[model samples]
Target: MELQDHIMHGVFHSNGFGHLLCLNGLEAVAGSNLSGRQIMNFWDHLCNALRARKVSLNDISTKRGMELRLMHGIAYKAPWFGSWGYKFSRGSYGVIQPMYEKAIDTLRAMPLCILVHYLGSSNHDIPIIFSRYQMLSDHSLTTLGDMFQFMLELKTRMAEENLLDSYTGPGMFVEQSCRWSPKRIEMATRAIVEALKRADFRWVSRQEVRDAARIYIGDTGLLDFVLKSLGNHMVGNYLVRRCLNPVTKVLEYCLEDVSNIVPTQDPKVKTTIHQYRMSKSQLMKDMLYLYKHILKDYPSSLNVGILSVVPTAVRIILDAKYFAKEYHEDQHQARVEIGSEDKLSVYCTIMLRNNNINIEGTTTTLPPLLPPFECVRLRRSATFNELMVEVEKIFRDLYWGMKNLILDSVANLEANGKDLVFGQVEVGGKVIFQGSNKGGIGEEMMYYEGGSNWNKVVVCGCGAREDDGERMVSCDICEVWQHTKCVGIPHHQPTPQIFLCKRCENEIVTLPAFP
Candidate 1:
């Protein structure tokens, strides 16, 4: 049947403007079997009336008549109109929210197959159907599934063109409204919800969806609410760190904080804070440039800033530990020895100095070592083994570089020492470094690696096994590479790194874990 005939058929016979009520009445009251005889009798009466008025089918099918009839029906069933006229007149694609609520509440809303019968047919009016669907944005699943297929295809195309990060799904949904016919808002909502179920698609919250719809629908209330909510929070830190590369929407939130962040009294801290502000100030320009790149088919040019804002924020959170630990541990020290070859070993001594960490007990024993004959003889022209020893030193140097940075920060805070005299035991051979004080009264040679080097090695000192049968070094989540004792983990076996490693631990520490 022609589109106008189908529409008029409902208008003249259906109780409401929407075919939903007519379809429901036909099934519930009239019975399951709709006959050709009943339909022909109705059409004959309509034709006779038209003939008496000298009205032609061609005139009846004209756009104006169809529109008038549709409008008339809509006006008659105002409560069930679903704002069909306003939506079409305004050129919007989404269904009215109230209409959708009513449709879903129907005793027998149009079944999926009946509603979709002409969807794949060429004669189907795309604009009308699309508009109707938008109005039903939160409608039944069958309609939603079709939308999922379309959205995924569109997203894939955008990604292939490298514009995926520049525009969000809701943004695309709104833009598509420019050409499509009106649809129920519930239907659009349902379509979007289903679309997000696909892999690589993220379902936005209802509020976000509503906001997007309102933008096209010209509802300022949602926009006002969103802006107000964002304004109340201290989101500046999270924005810069979490979303280093933000989209325009995210940047709007960031800009909201421009007037709030200010320099602190600490000069060093102020410098850092100033640098952060400067970076944030330029974020909008950077985002626009990124958007242009994605839109212009330069996908490779679209970097992390275009697609993510999480990792950098993670880095900031990780870096904050350096300050918090400094505030709490004012005085703590361990005996560190700097070796010529660059290796560090730590020992806790028994000294309780009031102001600093002190290790006064001299009971810890050390064994003597002799330089290997290969090291002495192979120094001039090194063999393969000697080459490996040199290579090992290079790694040690790099480690010391990192370690020194950590130690220098806490260098001045050593505890007091108590004088402990111990009886000396017989030495077996030549010592690596012997102290001048034989009774251990004054000082002893402590094994320390890499003097003036920041890359110091500290172990967690987890004896061996870990708590959950997970190996220490293998844990990517915690990254606790040292033993429990080395890292100050006071456990017999390896405790879950969660207890000691900064990332896994509940509290912050001075160590930089991400690096």
Candidate 2:
């Protein structure tokens, strides 16, 4: 019978209460027995309606329409919607009729055979139905077993089309399928191993390995499986290290030979080692340059006596044995002994006496000293790069220590109203301090006088020292010096006698005036 005829007969012949009653009371008999062909025709029509966008699955299952009410039974098994003889009194019937609503409900309670019939059919709309399986299952329209069948069929179809390799579907589905395929795991592992072997024992990112092996490892678990497979001693004796890629900053793997200390062909590792060594060597060269420049005769255009003490102060701090012990104790805790601090104080006193520079009543505190390592022992398996880093750290600490010592001595002499002077003694061609002489002592000697003070200078507005060779002018109000160029004053112009700094001018403008 035509669908419209069934709806007309069911709607018009029903009771006055608006409940649908089929013609000749056939609803009771029809609900008891639903045929497979009738169910297939209903699903086919629903699929066609869905494809044309005339009705959505949500509208069919949720709206109060006799034609689409059966979908609630099929999709959700809603008790009120699925109950026999329940009347849906709204929404016009689109494709389904009122008579078949009972039949569709009966089909909904049947076994999975009806689904098999629909899926196995040669209908062109089956693929569209397959795509909506997730949508159907999401609404509880299909069972777990139904979803399993859908996946199997979809995978089989993809394999038949030679599109499985290029299929970029959900990763969970691929992983589940791969998990059950032992042969695929083995092949992927072999490919990854070959890729690593070609990498020449260097670090490689996972994406790099994927491209090199031409195998898609979409998830970490699969890659982990391949790594575990490589760990088998029978496969290869590879030492695997998981480190961050220096360039990309991503986690990567380095598979190397167990016996090899370093990858000889890896330029990055070699370059890093060379950089560390060059840094250490450059630091040593700088230290020597500082010593030689300080001991050399000054240009007579600069302060020689104040600057000459810098090398001597550095030498005195470097020669202190207590400083060396402190550095060794800092690096190795097991070597620390009781009363170490007290012993360090005693050694400081001895070092001061040995230098013969007395600071009896002055505020000249000693600067903290860092030790340069006199001896270093490396393990047989340690790489040269590691040794270079350790040595570099030691030299860096010593360099900064020497710098701090020189600055501390100069500051103390300035604070105590004393000027630095060269002393009169020479030991091993390096001048040693006994006491200050009027005609000036040798270059390496350091002395301080009780009554001498150097000229006091203030920093300029350009954050440079007074001796920086920039032409400067002093503000008349605050007396703070500032560079002429920094204040927009032309160099060739004569200095203004009543110059005021920007800060003092702003302060004067901000002050309250008398009425």
Identify the leading candidate in terms of TM-score: 2
What C-alpha lDDT values do all the predictions have? Answer: 0.26, 0.34
Report the C-alpha lDDT of model 1 over 260-293, residue by residue, as the tens digit. Answer: 1221124333122111111221332332332232
> How does candidate 2 fare on TM-score?
0.17
Off by over 4 Å in 2: 1-456, 462-466, 476-479, 485-497, 502-515
Residue 288 C-alpha lDDT in model 1 = 32
lDDT per residue as tens, model 2, 1-515: 44422411222111111212222112323443443224434543443333321111111221111222322333333322222222322221111223234433443343332332332233323322322233222122233234333443343344222422211111011233455364455456556766777885477776677677665555556665555333312122243345556778875655545222211234332122110111323323332332233222222333343332333332222211110001122323222222233210000000112222223344332222222112233332333233333444433343321221211121112222132121211111111111111122121122211112112244555444433334668789877766777688898997798998888899899999989
* Global CA lDDT computed for model 1: 0.26
